[model samples]
Target: MASAPQTQSLPLFYKELIPLSRQDHAKYKMRPPETAPFLANVHAVPVTVEEFPMVQRRMPIVFSVGDDAVPLALMGLNEGVNLFVDDEGKLTDNTVYLPAYIRRYPFLLARLQPESEELSLCFDPSVDWIGEFDDGEALFTDGEPSEFTKQIMQFNEQFEQAGQRTAQFVKDLREMDLLMDGEVSIQPEGAPQPFIYRGFQMINEDKLREMRGDQLRKIVQNGMLPLIYAHLMSLSLMRDLFGEQMRSGKMPQPDAGV
Candidate 1:
């Protein structure tokens, strides 16, 4: 039998993205998608990045109509739960995709507030995840440049933590063997699988390809609320599959994450 798959080494050289928020975040309470309970599958590693305290509080943002403090939260579509929300809000159902490049760059991102009383969330093909905004219905829509949107859309601060935190993320993977594609093959059922082989965390390219479906389902089931990287992917896939789902029917409102 082939040896266990080799784990993909964590890309540790790319952690300086904390300061990239070029936009100020203190100003707005990011809202949930106009509608929600979207699909998603996300995992949270519990390590603290003191330099960037926000890392530990990672969650998808949620917003609702007729409220004042849109919330920021953490949610996995598969879990059917939003880790955090300022208050009650609606979420959209959609799926998304991400570049493998996300592992290198912290999945920094934002879910912009919606415009009108629209019951949908729109997506942009650009790198950042942007929501609909129209002052005709709410505030911050001059078809002009402004900082509010950035507060709702920007990269996250996932890796800025205690030195050992990132090290631990690396160490966890190292302890297990990863299945690299082309290096291994899946054995037929009923065939006795090798021991010391099953336990290794599998990450083979073939396996990665197979897992594509699950990953996509994750995005759809949790599209309403997405993890940093997952949200990034949503905008892309959402565009491809449903652009109408991406836009707001009308512009509208809120704030709250406490």
Candidate 2:
């Protein structure tokens, strides 16, 4: 759910990546897409530690399964469903906090070559946001990046930094052996069986509580305890999300299984 994209493996919502350059795209302009059709069917999106406070309030915060367990904001409990966004990819609730991972779509900082130490601003060519359009923000000014382009580059750079910090946070959790397979069961009225959801990882609350005083203090000092608590608090929202799905008639039949 939170696999990092490599050169050989394209990232989610991106069909083809092309390095942004003045020579190749001097006439290109950027305009926001009318609707994000790419997000219509995506359920889980990778999130960073920096976004925990806001993200937790809006959606359940869980970790993806596997060795590279990254925090994921559960937009929907099941795959190919997003309760927050409608079929057009527009948010059903305008106030919902959109994850940075989604906001940074179509543009990212990527290494041009596998062996290169430097990263370049790259974008998905398939997106309609960037093109040689008559009406949009210019990508270049006098053969150099325009202010808009520079701002985009800056945002992607910050995202990369946040990603690194998030990686460290996950590493710390793994070192403390605090991650465990997560499960959530929801029983609706008159349902014969509860809907059981699995295939995700979450913090082991028991292990966290059992940690030595010194270790606890260390985490508190490092500002991880609050983030952990935020994640724990967000779990309750899973039911709220399930309810939304049910109300929208998006929930599958009980026998279908999640």
Candidate 3:
């Protein structure tokens, strides 16, 4: 039995979100992302368990603090700044891997009703690239999802499933008491003070190392060890991200107390 509808905060870059209904959105169309960088201000994005390996190589992966504790790929060290994005919103380094979370933007699977387990395909209507257009891909045909819409829905569904797996991964970390407070500090060559970052959680190496051999084996067998290592290794990039911020001068100084 489904619960009542729940309201979730919109993800980054989403201004206004509404369910994609055949009736309301039948005339709408979607086109490939335009030149304007929709992610320019987005410094971090959600990451799935499957994305840890690829994302770890390109971005600093960390966990959000508190009960919901989702993994995030940090693109910049501070808020309102994304080191990878240029003034035009295009990625500065095309070769770098983009997290699936960003790639799935503008479309998402959401539970419209709290009691209902069924998810609805939803979109950020404010995304300029998607709207009423005759030349672009239609969202619906004959009041049914068009092929393009179907593809988008499929991707959204996959993202949602990945999100579930990611949630479980976080839960496992919590259950194992493996998560601990994380702090990172970085200073550029000419900077007077190091940028200190906090308010995030990360895997505790000490706890992990102290785990019994059998427990460690279980995690290794489940393929979680590599993911943990990836996250720990990715923390080294905090300095690199700080360097980008210095070079671009896009963000203000890091919070003194953070």
Candidate 4:
């Protein structure tokens, strides 16, 4: 769901990335987009371990499939559907917690040179938020980044750090052999067969219970146990998401096979 910028492929939601600099963009201003059309069809998004509790309350937390598994918040049970947002990508309910990955859109810290250890603040040039607009927050003030720019930079930095911790959390789960291929089946009334959803990873609750006491204590001491439980707890919300899709008439036909 989240990808790093590379020479061959740009990260999700970014069409083109350029390092933000005063020299080239002294007059650029940032205005919040009234709608996020990019998110209209995105069903899932990468999320950090730090957001487990809050995310669990609103959506199912599942791991992306494959060797390099990362946590994802399921905005919808199926592809091309988002239960929480309208077609214009505006939140249907304002109280839902928006993931940091969504909120940090159009801006991220990336390495300007692949060989360099330092990262620079970069933004997607295609987004309407940043441009030479007259009615928005100035990106630069007197040849320096303005307070708003500084705050955005800081937020991206913190997101990067959270991403690092999330990576480690996933690594630890793999090391402990705790993740398993996940699936969920739901049968609506009058349906002849249940709808099945797969292609994700989830905590192996049985194996988690079978772990040695010392290992369990270690996870508890390291503050990972709660996060793991939070993920497990969130799985129950999958049905709620399915219901939301049904209510919105976004659910696939019974024979469509999700």
- The number of clashing residue pairs in each candidate reads 55, 0, 11, 0
lDDT of 4 by residue, 44-147 (tens): 99999999999999999999998988899999888888888889988888898989999998898998767778888888888877899988999899999999
lDDT of 2 by residue, 132-208 (tens): 99999999999999999999999999999999999999999999999999888889999889888888898999999
The C-alpha lDDT values of all candidates are 0.26, 0.88, 0.81, 0.88
RMSD in Å for model 4: 3.2
Q: Rank the candidates by lDDT, best first.
A: 4, 2, 3, 1
User: What are the models' TM-scores?
Assistant: 0.22, 0.95, 0.91, 0.95
Better of 2 and 3 by lDDT: 2
- Name the better of 1 and 3 by lDDT: 3
- RMSD to truth, every model: 20.8, 3.6, 2.9, 3.2
- Model 1 ranges off by over 4 Å: 1-35, 40-145, 153-168, 172-258
TM-score, predicted candidate 3 vs. hidden true structure:
0.91
- Of models 2 and 3, which has the larger TM-score? 2
Instruction: Point out where model 4 deviates above 4 Å.
Output: 1-6, 253-258
